[model samples]
Target chain A: MYHLISDIIRQSEENECVFWEIVQQADADERGVSKEESFETMRKMYQAMREADEHYDPKVRSASGMAGGAGQLLHEYNETGENICGDFVGKVMEKAIKMGESNACMHRIVAAPTAGSCGVIPAVFLVAEEMLHLSEDQMVEAMYVSAGIGSVIAENASLAGASGGCQAEIGSASAMAAGGLAYLQGGDAGQIADAAAFALKNMLGLACDPVGGLVEVPCIKRNVAGAVNALTSAQLAMAGIKSAIPADEVIDAMRRIGNEMPSNIKETSLGGLATSPTAQKRIV
Target chain B: MNIFDVVGPVMVGPSSSHTAGAVRIGYIARKLLAEQPRKVQINLYGSFLATGEGHGTKKAIVAGLLGMQTDDERIPMAFELAKQQGVDVSFGEANLKDAHPNTAQLILQGISGQTIEVVGQSVGGSRINIASIDGIETNFSGDYPTLVVHNQDGPGYVSAVSTLLTEQGINIAYMQLYRSNRGGDAVMVAECDQEVPQHVMERLKQVDGIGKVTYLGMMGDE
Candidate 1:
């Protein structure tokens, strides 16, 4: 029901509460569930996301043979104290790959918005568990923030690659993650809104070009980028940076741009990297 | 859109449109048959054919026919599962004119001699539409509790079905009716707010002019 992030923010301010409370109450109203029931549902979702990451099986390969041991490789690299990214981020990147690989291998995954972009929020939460020592309740609160932002994107733009391209899928995930990250770090509603806006605007017009029409190739790696992008946006917002355009306007732009995008790049796998010379050779 | 629609629908993945959505089409096809499927022929059209192999659309569909949910870990091994369950499954490329790229047609034969043909489209974000059932032009997304009623075209057929639903205290959310020709075969697609009970469906079948009443009550949780 919250079509704009500003709406959620305004409601939160008026109610003297955090963003998740506003979103959670709205969920309660929409579903006709009690507040406790709605939060319980969200808590179960967070648990499922965590479980998907914790139970990742690196031994299993995707049917296409493209994504399996990469998460293991990243994990080993993160442990060596030799990675280019920080230890926390390296671990986050590691989880992102594992979750997406689990998805490809047909293991259970919480498709936050969509299955292909499933890794971003879980990656952030996984790293938060090990590094920041967040509790289950705190993580569930952050999930509400992400869900709120994702709801807006789903309504205004899209969460399907076929509809708006990767910009809508991974792009929406990044924004949702950014808002959640901002919430976890105790940023105000404006900061959370700016973080989501910053993340989404950065990924505007990104294409959904998986090789051979599979959610591998660039798709798996894009989850990593989305997780990393969310982190950057959250950090910028906490540092008081604001998006030039409002968050709602950015989402509207995503809708217009997605409509303007051709079907080839919109998950048809006919163009973009899906048709690249090297990508063509790698198609399963 | 529901907030849950944004956050999660815990499922097996890769491509929601190709993989999870394919599983749903298979699941619905199984439900429509109203019995265990002894044999199923799944025909993929457009992108479902061009790249369905990589997406494991065949396996996903087979898993669905085997009564597996979208998040079932056995999805990758659906072919094996189908064989173990003694269900005959076959796949072929289809040319569904004017259908969406991610479409599948399933011809199902049940254990008790029941049969139904279903054409469904994976219309992105893991949602699907049962566009055709048994050569009849019907369109409905399985997002609600639904009833697919087959009846001879009569003045009171629609009222008869709605009256039964009304008797059960079930509110109708959406309804669509289709018939091949006037005064011939007709179908009424009713999506309800409450689950349509089995006895109500049985009673509907016994009603005058009504043929078969197939129901789909609630979706996505599984």
Candidate 2:
């Protein structure tokens, strides 16, 4: 029998999360501070998370919300030669539309380990790459580290919100992204692990309950959140703040919270914003 | 040495059940035909048939026939590319009994006038099993070098076959001997650590119980 766990970790490296961890370790060593020293790092990340939350001003002024078609934005940025952030975000959103367009795409789009969350890693990684001028090798390495962390969470906790809750879904994605970022930004394997655990722990008990089963609504928005959380966690870990709570303890909390959450808050589309009168009316 | 034991696949995905699974079904169908197909027909069954179109099932089938992996981003353009590569495609429906919901039947015709029928299912994450071929019951996952032989049930057939492999220095990773009954229809699936030699195949055909010998080679390796 094949060892599925080993295969998953190997594939995660093939996908580049492992090398990302290496970069983080290098940076952490350069700073002469352990990732554990950044114990209060998560609190600062929370503030960044709040700031990120406010950035999605999805209106006419907000390029993120333009309805004429966001698809053109990526191509437009690529043509205009602005920062790839605009181009990258546009690409992520375009992938989301393409994903919705065909069912047999078989992209295995990593969901909160979910399919929708697939873009989150790419989004944050792309941003980091552009900002830090990291090489493709570094990005690939980070992805492997991220994959390792994600696979562990998948094995020990749950990536499916239905199984554990949104905490597992988006939270897991955030954690994996954080681990990836931390690794890329110069944290050690242990610090990378801590950063990941901290990210997931902070977001534990998030609900799914997408207003529509369609991968729109909160799905796209959550991608933004996942990206921001990952970067924030990396920054905190690099700053030497460690999560006081153990990673395993946080996973347990996520599971317990998920169990306590009603099914409506899962993927059932029964509660939360999914059941709002406006959301019900908007159902296609 | 099951076919699934060796090969790992990469796939595109919203859901593996919906997307990657469909693509694997198509890829195997194309490979079974021996020649790149001129026209392909697919029948979706159960949940696969029901929600396939929504999940890009049709696109996946076309992509698979063109030898694309599930994770390959080219799946969306599979049809246009297949046309460029001189393959035609169509779809229909079929219901299989007690099968996984993600299942399909593919009937393919090569430019050489040869036809192949394949029944398969996508279990999850783009993994699939080739359930049957040409109304004959067969089980194959495209992971190994397999020789699927249909023969008459006779005494000492197993020993003869094993002896031949031993003589040839071929390691029999797995030998499954299946027979309908005594002196009746029988089939032996020999999955090997390496490809079986043509001489070995010829020797197996000369055995008393052997009737037909078809070397499937490696699944999906053109």
Q: Write the per-residue lDDT of candidate 2 for residues A29-77, one digit (tens) a residue.
A: 5445564432123223322222222222222121112121333453355
Model 1 residue runs over 4 Å out of place are B219-222
On residues B20-118, what C-alpha lDDT tens digit does candidate 1 reach at each position? 899999888888887888988999998888888878899999888888888788888998888887888888877578888888999999988889999
Q: Fraction of native Cα contacts kept in each candidate?
A: 0.88, 0.25
True interface contacts retained by model 1: 0.88
Displacement of the residue B202 alpha carbon in candidate 2, Å: 5.4
* Whole-model lDDT, model 2: 0.61
- The interface RMSD values of the models, given in order, are 1.1, 12.3
- DockQ (C-alpha based) per candidate is 0.80, 0.22
lDDT of 2 at A121: 60
lDDT by residue (B29-86, candidate 2, tens digit) is 7666656788888888876775565456788888888887766778877878988998
